[model samples]
Target: MSTRKDSLKFTMTSRALKLLGQNLYARPWSAVSELVANGIDAGATTIYVSMTEDPATNTGTLEVLDNGSGMTEEDLEHYVSIGFDKRAVTGTLKSSRAPMGRKGIGKLAALYLSNEYYIHTKTAPKAGKQFDSSWHMQLDFMTDADKEPTLREINATTIPTIHLNEQFNKQDSGTLITIPEIELKGLGTQAFKSLASRLAIHFLKDVLPDLKIYFSHQKINEDPRFKEVEWHPAYGNFLLLSTTKSHTYVQDKIKRKVLIQSASRKDSTTVETSITPTPSFPLNDFENADIANHISTSHNSNTISGAYFPDPLSTQTYPYDLKGWLALHATIKTTLAQDNDSTFTKNQFFSPTQIRLYVRGKLALEDLRPYLNLTEQYANYLEGELQFDLLDEDDLPDIATTSRESFDTEDPRFTTLCILVRDWAQILINERSRIAQREKERLVKITANANNAYAKRLSQSIQKLSESKKRPEEVIQEVHLGLTDNDPLEPDAHTAAKEEYRIFISHSSSNKPIADIIYDMLIELGALPEEIFYSSKDTVSTDKTKQFKMLEKQIRETITDAATKICYITSKGFCSSVYCCFEGGAGWATRAVSDYELITTTYAHKPDWLDAGLQTTSIIDQTGTFTLNRETYMLFTQTINRLVEHLNVGRRIKQEPLINSILEDKIPSDYKLRTRKEKISDYYNPILADMITHAGKSDHSAEV
Candidate 1:
């Protein structure tokens, strides 16, 4: 075979070059960022970016002026060459700063914002020259298509103009790039803000103290200084995790005997597969002492393991040089706005939850939450920034996408970084969960104690009522009124109860006997009869025509005023009676079943409409008598007690006489009510006897 040497030439159409320039940057902010980055690379102490708009023409001019080492005639020629590798040829800037421009295509970024641009630069004089020389290059994107021009052919037509002395004096050397005829259609006031924010993040870690980027915009008759872009703090008050030493994992030797089986022989073998700790940078020594302690004490082993990032490059090692902070603000305040002396709207930069990644002091990724796979609730409360300079090493493959908005997730470094972030996020989430649970338990304990104390005071008041010489019903009524004055059980409950009655007794007229008994029990337990609205006792009109009206009025008043209702579900005429059904329905419609108690006697059957799981009191036995079982009695008493407690009734008794005594004779004279100390015993004796006699009878008929 014969080999022939041939030379090939690369050519690009003007349209293709224009498209390439347009696609180089996704947003105007990104185009500006490229220029600012170039300024930083040139060791510029101050870079001024200004935009001037002409409203009548609807166009603007964008200018970037940097007081840094400028280009000479040779440099100008190289700058105009497309696809030139500046970093490879020049190594670094004259100031010994690492050059940011690599492919030398950043200059195309200007075409993204404007069609015409001009560059004026002056470099220091050669060895024996008395003054520096200046050069300028003008580029017009609206080139004639008929010319079929190449980048080299176009540069040949516009030779760099040279001057004897430095142009735009006061500085030894500098570059001034002006992009005229800037299309300002999409560039509004917010564009400047977006640009500032993006630039701040781009230089967050690497921006030198002396480097200042002043951004400003000017409109007709407007002050240019009014809306100057200000630097804002991206993250604030976060737990800092700065690295003092870099550590890598290594395999440690450990002696261990293991059983090994071979085709010819079986024997014990020694194997080593353990990790050794490094002395200079301990694998377990977190830069932040607090974080180290937290990880050590954490109960979740998974979280602890996740916080440890192992070296992807090493077979048995963890990478530990990355430095940053992990912060969780259950409540986020805009630190960036405060630092910038500005205000933030809801949908601005720095969301409530964000995991930003920085490389070489520049933000490579804004949000890693999507990659973290953390719970949305917890992720929404997190915000942090991590800097890993190694990711930006020139030798490493470029992981950033063309847009430079984020890194390629397929990259190992990116994947590992996401894993590390997820682990740290998990640790923070677990710690937050622990804190919330502890707070919840503490609050529950406090509430329980308060309820117990409230119940005790109430019980004491009932005991005092039993000691008073006044009738049991009268003392009960007073206590009920006092308790209903204001509910002390819960602050919000108290506010809600203020306009409602304490209790509403819903029962059939045929079941008045049981209702009377329950009424007396409630009174004894410190409930007011007035607060206990029963249609039979509450309605007062006697005339036949007015009787229905009065009953209707009482039902409406009771239903409207009631906070809790007690339904006596008896089988006799309870469910069949329209009035009783209405009352029960009204109560049910107004409040939840939890606010009412269902007391069913022996004759009562559970309704199909009623929930089977509702809190119910079944006191009546098969004999139609209230159950004498100690547990049953306690259950009944406890139900009433709960009602009393919820109503916030007074814990003290007041002895007073009834205004009218016409029904004094109706009260049982043989009711052997004793002093407060013996009231429980005396009250139960007669009640027990009546229940026993009722049980002993063969008759199934009962009035209750």
Candidate 2:
């Protein structure tokens, strides 16, 4: 074999070389990258960040100061230049590094984060130079005449302002990158904790494997207070083997490898993750004769089967080094070990961890957003990441991106890559599922224990409220609710949850204050805000419809599925006007079944005459029988709380599954088809019977 080194000359002048400027990387994390790259380049033992923010613009002001070897005047010139390719990034690292940015283009990504980026340094044996550049319009104006590099000498005056945490002056040498105009999009205090957490996790696994890492003022990686950090592979350190055996078996064997322990809670540990080669598995290889012409490898049915993968999953084996082994990885979120706030950063939400498929030790595919909706999905749970590696670039050319941050699916080797990735994905997803189940069970047990403790605390509060002669001022400030809708306990076997119901709200203009309070009270009591309708001037929008969407909004916002009765708080306001009568009538007519209630201490001397010419309202006295609004709030809160208690959190719940439910088995007899001609007079009894039956079973029969 003969070997020779080849070289190419750059005929283009320094000025002609394209200055990528800011439009280099895609996202905000680029700033994170530039500094980290410098740290890796400097071979620093520690990297500290002082990331500040301005609420007005929701932007960041971050400074990454490290204690790595500094640059000299000669080195500084080339260091600041746009041509790093002319120089070498390879250095004596504290340890080896795969180099996060393979394209040597991440420096341009920094321009995406800040309008102004300043690099100040004080290296060994020479005074430091200060260079500040404006990335704004750089991408769009890279060719503009006015565009010029901004450089200056480091002097005493600029030192104090730019040198944050001035420990660098007396020290040996290091680099400082100041993102003066950090234009963070959708970042805030909420994202700060999140960004730090992500950096900690990524650095822990890929970048800073040999040393301890820190974030903020906290020792995220190695504080004595915190246990040692490690990501233990499930199969310990297993040998990666490959053979001429079926690729499906290769996938199956890969699937059978091991998983990593959960960093979070016990239930959240990864255990069942592995690639499967079995044909019976959903994410395995297959063969399709119709598209046979497309395959170039001239595979028999068995070989095509290796290339064939399921749609969406592409369950097929990914080609690897015809001789080397495949490497796959799974992820787990430390539910128990992690801080509760780990899943978010500056309002940016992420899953606890992700299911990443890899081959030959490179990331191939991952779904960060199962549905691309962390906010829309199980809100309380979101935060995760994935790292994978596939076959050697030679065997899986189409399987890897040039930079390898992404995968190239439609490539020539894509079919095999799809099968491998799909199998790996299933394994990773399975691990995540197991962890999720364990987490849920653990949460349930913890909640049950907490509830027992809560019950005792609630007992004390109940006692105090009962014994107190004068109610606390808090009671007066709180919103009030109306009557309860306790379905009569039937002597016969009862069904599960009841039928569709509404919580009617009746009010007069004079009592808007109380009525508003009542509406809030009902919501706190677990009533669907949609089930309660309120009359508000502001509720209407400019695009007014004849149906008066305002009324719909008012009702929908206040009502919920569990509501089934109306609480009528009447007063002198009621007997005096049409406003009061209309309010009551609206509540009555708006529901599938309307139950009215009145709150007061005094009964009308002549009740019917006092409410003459108006719709009928069931009135109750506040003197007894749960007359107090607060009492109703408590009652309803308790009832709804029970329903909530029964319905498990983070798990889907259906009305039909509720034990001993209402509408489930006993639909009200009245729901039977009533003929338009059957007559209003003949309908009352049968309709009522059906109503009673349905009231005892099933879902609300409608959305609130």
**CA lDDT of each candidate?**
0.52, 0.40
Tens digits of per-residue lDDT for model 1, 179-243: 77777785677765666666655665433556677776777556455233454332232221221
> Compared to the true structure, candidate 2 yields what TM-score?
0.42
Worst 10 residues of 1 by lDDT: 246-255
Residue range 56-140, candidate 2, lDDT tens digits:
6655566666766655555555555553432234342223444333334445445556544556565555356443221122222
Q: What value of lDDT does candidate 2 attain over all alpha carbons?
A: 0.40
> Each prediction's TM-score against the native?
0.50, 0.42
State the number of backbone clashes in model 2.
76
Model 1 gets an lDDT of 0.52
The candidate that wins on TM-score is 1
